[model samples]
Target: GDANRAEAALARAEGRIPDALFLIDQARIAFLEHDVSGTEDYWAACRIADEVGSTEIWLDIEVLATPEEHDTWDRLRTLPAADRDACAFFRRFWNRRAAAAGMGVDDRIVAHYQRTRFALDHYRRRGRVRPRFAARLGRPTNSVYDDRGLLYVRMGDPDEVAIHGGSDCIEPNISWAYDRPGGYRIYHLSPLAGVDDWYLQENLAIVYRCGSWDRNPMVAISPLLLDVPGQPFHDLYLSRMGLDPRYARIANHALSLIGDAFAGSRLAEELTVEREWTWQDGEYAISTVPERPAVDLSVDFALEWLQFRAPRPGLTRVWLNGLAEASALQPVEKEGQDVYRVQIVWTLLDETGLFYRFIPSSFDAAVDGPLDDEAGLSLRKSADLPPGTYRWMLAISDANSTADGQGKKVRGGYAGGDVVVRDLGTDLPVLSDVAVSADSVGAWSPTAGISLNPTPARLTGDDGVAFIYYEVYNLTPGGMYETRVVLQPEDGGPSFDLSYPGTAQRSASIVTRGHLRIDLSASSPGRYEMSVTVRDLTSGHVTLPVRTDILVTRD
Candidate 1:
């Protein structure tokens, strides 16, 4: 209802000033209501209304957002109004995120708003923002959030939070622990500038230091006084305690107080560590956590991809066909059946800021017969893309696995390499990548009858014959052509080659498609490279042979 009214008001306020003012008001209202998408939309609209219209309105938006989000808004504001590329990026970023979360974009937007709202309500500073503590709290001095709010914006609420009031000798501090996905992260926060203004303290010693002794000017203070020598402070502290009974008491107290499931010994150990450090002014240094780098798991898998000219000009149809071993997947029981679920993502990017990502396949395949050591599930997908030089990545992950610290599902198999798609000139005969099938073929692109099921692992079981499909372009009328297929073992072994002469059945302007049945029955089971080439016998024109590797399994 409010959105409708805002739209009506915006339509009425056609001028730059009125529209900007109205949109700014709507943005603030949305921000207060914890509507991140709405606020961003209104903010972007206002900026597009007039880039130089009002600096005050930009300030208003920044004031309402977390320091991190303020940077995001600032970047968007500086871009040209209604920039197509920027708008596309914004939509793609949110849409891809929504797909990964297995929800609609709207739901993802709502969830993000909820997280920010929680931070604003809970982590915002209760008192005035002190200028001296601004850098310690986060960026943008006008932000109302403390250190906790800044952290919350970057990483959603920690799995466990504990507010520990200072004992007589210790300083008041807050402890946070994340133990689930991306290993363990334990953070400590101290009120560096009074009660309401908190700063992230890298020094664990500050939490339990004797305030009186540290303040004494006579004591020779080393800058190292604040630095704890151990990483993952939880382990080293407990190790230093050396079988102290106090560990159990602290753990039990923490479990009871914070209701953290993993708090038994871990939290207890951390708490004990907190109480052991001496007070010192540690150099305020913030740790830089890299944003969501892909976690690649060492898993056995195989991939084969082929590309052909798409129906539209300047676009190529890409087909990815491969299989993953059963060991690479985690079997989860669903509806009385143990099934392996996996999510496959393909991403393409270039230095020119071109980015395209798609979830090609996601499915739960039920276990059949033995959980094979060779191959568990077959993976295949087709997509049409424009010509470009891109670094492409294909990621396959166990869908049942828990999300890592950065919220990406732990990937089981990952592969990346550079790829170049170019326009196939009509003047020369160019052959597409050979599409091979161990079994039967199916319909695909280029032509209605061109579908071929690419063999998994490039394997030809029981039957020794491999079916191959390919298209040849720029043919002459009634052209006499020779199609040659070769099977050569990577190992120094005997090779097999076949050449068949045929007349072009299609017009010179159309692509000439053909298939071959290569007998590999007598060949030994091993890895072989299959290459295909077509030659115009009458015109003495030949194509550059395209080759793909295949793994032939024992019958």
Candidate 2:
């Protein structure tokens, strides 16, 4: 026997760091030879394995040192080589177990495993014989010699253990109690046939089976008691035992726990939260249903486009809630139906000759029948006002009346942001806001670009040309002016220049309009600065140059 064990030890020491495996081999041989130093040998092997960063070897030693069923040993040997690496395999196994228990592995799994291994070493050093399988001569028993050890591996250490009933005709048994969050679980176990093997017992018709153990033991139950179902070891164990419905419920709860845990992760926020109110503080294209009567008349109406996918086919009403200075506007009434509206009023914040229009606008679109899943709503409204900062709140509501007319109408969601309307001063030769138009669709108004569709200040070579529109106001009556357009790279590069001569007629109020198109198909992809300069040749004064940045992209 010594020669055989020495040969096994020699084999283990070959082609490997000798200390950990050699010590494990010594422990195994000593245990087989019934040497009293076996526990010390195993402990030394564990320490060395840990020191060498060979925790897998330490786990293997623990497994070999524990008693297990013969079939468990057979199954373990048949495991794929990938699964035989104890560290990696058990890490994944415990993570799965923790997830099934509705706990995150990041929180408590490593501590649990460490405590289990510590308990095993503590009990073994005390020479306390743990419950193991009934050892049969010449048959391999892979079962842990200690039933409590096996339970500890599966469920972690219990809160308390109580021994009862070794007196009179009552057979002695031990109860392991766990005070867990969901509830308390108490296991009743007793030795089988006065041996090291402990089996679960049913009392009062309640079967407390040792689900983690093999070789079920029988116990007499009181007939007067109603039969109670056995408790499973764990959720995953229940699933493995073919309890599909119970496992499904447990899995759903576990999924909910996972969702709650990582709900605030960056990836989750990116997927669910939208950055819709990040519009820059600038005048956006305001399209009105009816065009303004004159250039001097304040704009009384504005429309903002709102588009979103509906979760289901139904009437969706989108409206705006005005706050702060915008509260002056009354709710809009259309066909006797109260609708949300934003009123824009022009007010001069300073005596610097700048007038601002605070325009409040809102509307809703109603869909009545089944529509494309990717459905959208277009809304428009009018508001009269001077320029000022207005806080606008856009809300969407379910208009269930479009259906059979029964569901309760409720506000679904809302987005709020501030909009600034800068005043175009009339005292100087000022240019109106530059409008970049991509297509020629309507009668081009010098005050507004064709179609009034804001280009998002971007151009692509595929469009060939970009239409530019703006009006110069307060020019000297009967004045001759030289207008120049310069396009240069935003990085102060050489510029392309165009100059034209124009004359303003003598009138009470003078305004000069200009419309031009720039060929962009030849431009490279980058941000370009477009500057419009007007020189009043009669006064030899150049109006403040109006500059706008446009981004160009390759087709």
Candidate 3:
């Protein structure tokens, strides 16, 4: 006000001020005329704008997702795009790879698109933890508050995740993590093994780029404590430091390493495809391509899914992979919205190919709860399953694909993946050198040189993971490890069975494969235990230390 007015007065004194100066004088006139304030000080302009609700000065903190989309969109979007060069290279790689595999670019892209959406949702900030409404959508979850809990579902075990940090191993990336959700203690999220720099920032994860791996936790949330119902890590830290001050120093380093490692391993991941489409948002049309997969189903296998798809104007014929089967998905209201979902269960009838066996009565998705206005398509396992590979095939078509009741001309596109069932329950007749061999019990002798495939993860901080190395000597010589495990009691729990098919095709064959599983209701939550006994038919040996406890939780 002073400077501009001073200049204006000088102009007026000179008797030649410009007409544009009239607005400033008018504003001053209005201020005096209205007697709102004595002086129109620029510094107080901001307050006035706020009081008047000026668009430029006001901010809206309302949550953005609609009530119907909450379940699907309530996750963070973590990955920054890879380098331009790398992404281009990936695109070219896909083009070549798909051509060789007898698929189109769109087909392969659509298949992975869902995964991209999952990653973004899981890691991205969903919304303000608490804006105007009293909601807690952004926090780590529990069963009822989260529908996608099963999306990251870790079944079969929750024997606390272990973390490990090695001395002098500065920034050793312990880049290992389970691809899916479950009761897991996230051991590492940084390039340095055993570190935890949780900075929930987009740039943090970009370090996982294959070409130039960033040495930091890909997506660090910093060192914030979770409002846990049980044990407290911060309290544990204080106690450990009191016992040995070096413990404090080591603990911090361990966490950092785990963080780095977690981020590092993410670099090797195959990117998932993702897309967001809303009929209400616009007049835009979304097109899709599809693919199918087949797997054998025998006693060794317990679950399988087939995908069906078509474009906007069509319905599709359902099938077991490519083998035709009778299936139907009723369009109904879900999550306060209408959706089309189905589950297909099949049996093996031929020695060489898959046979369309049975279509269970349910056309509902294997999902957790009711879809509020926000539900999307997701799969849920309804029963405890045996060891084997269960393939999910999806046939997606445009909403109008109801050639109906008869089932034909229904075509869109498809996508899918495989789930491996490991013996989580039952008796493990033999485990060559199970974790605590020192506590030897009534069990079998070790098979020398046997090897358990090493998972691409490592320990950091106090977190630890154990791998059991072994080999099936010879089934022809007669051998199988039968171990049974049960889920612990909780709001939601995990269950599994144990089966050891020999080291050959039997181990991999869905038909004659090794199978050990526990059947459980998806609605329950809790911890599960395994009371397993292993016996070796070939060596006439028995393995002991048969009991282990694992905790699982859900909504």
Candidate 4:
């Protein structure tokens, strides 16, 4: 509700003052509320105004936000955007906020979630959960915009734009008064062609002229999306050819994929009457064909050993696809059954990272009821889940959960529409280094993932620290893995390491590139280590072993 009120206030400000600060203020309000784009734009404005000072820029003022305020934006622009921008912003902000508050903000991300929740009671669609959750940004639904829902984001607040505001000398004498921070002003001098003109008070350009708000949204698939599979394909689609691609990695990737596939080269041919789809948009099947030509084949199987148990007493549901007979969950073995299945191993994972081969929660067993059931899918069986439309995926067999050695590998899979178990969690300790060229980020853009070739950068600064984190996956059961990384310069210059105890952890750990930050002041440095040991903990077992060498250094 606060965001809605703030938005409404901002919209009305466009009428009250034809300045940019009001819009910028509104954007700040959204940022304070964790509006992803709003936070990004505000910081961008704030940073740009400070570093590249110009009369036309209306963003964060160095006089108010200080040089430190612009520092975040400066550092953030180097990131690849998306959550990266958001993450960097908070890291910078919290550092400042902590200094201001005299205490550190919790580093655990999910912990800060509550403070960001939206007030659904206000400025929400008639019957929706949370605003963004129920409403797609660009898609037409019961949203506020139709078709393109055109929007323009500028630097600062619109109300603060200066212009003639007096009734003197027969001319319109209007000028913005409150040009300082903490206050936003706007002027609604006039509306033209049903579109009102508003500009920021400071640097102007903080004008926002939103089209007629749509109560019943016009539904179109969004051009913004994610890299994960089973997601609504956007940005990369044929329709979003002319859309803004900011923060649209998934869509951007798809667009790139399409380009690589030369989809445009065959656009005219694919749209012909004879070359249509078996499933139209939104599964609105418009075809007369009895069976779809593409039948995805798969299998399901259980691991040879497992002690499956749920955390609490709940319905043990069994589902799979492919073959004729169902799993052994319910005995009475039927004839002609294929035994290939993908079992979900949960014990093997946790948020910190993952070890290989954790036990599963369910195993194959014989049931007394029903025929050798056909492969199937499942959803929450009431009482256990909330009431909402949740999508799910089904597996006919274990093969559905996996691909053959020759076939492409899929990182994750869905048991039902909602329960997605990605085959990937943590990568076995691969080395990566974080190297910041300068203490003050001014002209320095930090680089990571260092190598031994070419020219290695010299790391500088007091308390200069390099973070080396490795990801691990598919570890041997009960078998421990250990690897020691050595840091050194190519020409026997200098190196560093984590001081003793803090440097080591069972199986995996993070260590300094070298013990002395001064050692890395050389022109070029190389981090060299020989032999990484990865052991599977299982006793007397021929466990599959995987080793990953992590290269961690401060560039």
**What's each prediction's TM-score?**
0.61, 0.31, 0.20, 0.18
lDDT top scorer: 1
Each prediction's RMSD over C-alphas, in Å, is 9.4, 28.5, 27.3, 29.0
Which has the higher TM-score value, candidate number 3 or candidate number 4? 3
Q: Which order, best to worst by lDDT? A: 1, 2, 3, 4
Off by over 4 Å in 2: 1-384, 393-416, 443-454, 457-461, 490-495, 553-555
lDDT per residue as tens, model 4, 65-94: 223344545565555534333333434443
TM-score of 2: 0.31
Better of 3 and 4 by lDDT: 3
lDDT for each residue of candidate 1 in 50-70, tens digit (9 for 90 to 100): 544345444532422344545
- Model 4 Cα shift for residue 245 (angstroms): 30
Please give the lDDT score at residue 182 for candidate 4: 23
Return the number of clashes found in candidate 3: 148
Question: Which 10 residues in a row give candidate 4 its minimum summed lDDT?
Answer: 285-294
Per residue, candidate 3 scores C-alpha lDDT tens digits across 156-240 of: 1112222323223222222211211121212222222212222111111121223122333322432221221011222233233
lDDT of each: 0.58, 0.41, 0.28, 0.27
Q: Which stretches of candidate 4 lie over 4 Å from their true place?
A: 1-159, 164-427, 435-555
List candidate 3 stretches off by more than 4 Å: 1-395, 398-473, 476-481, 490-534, 537-555
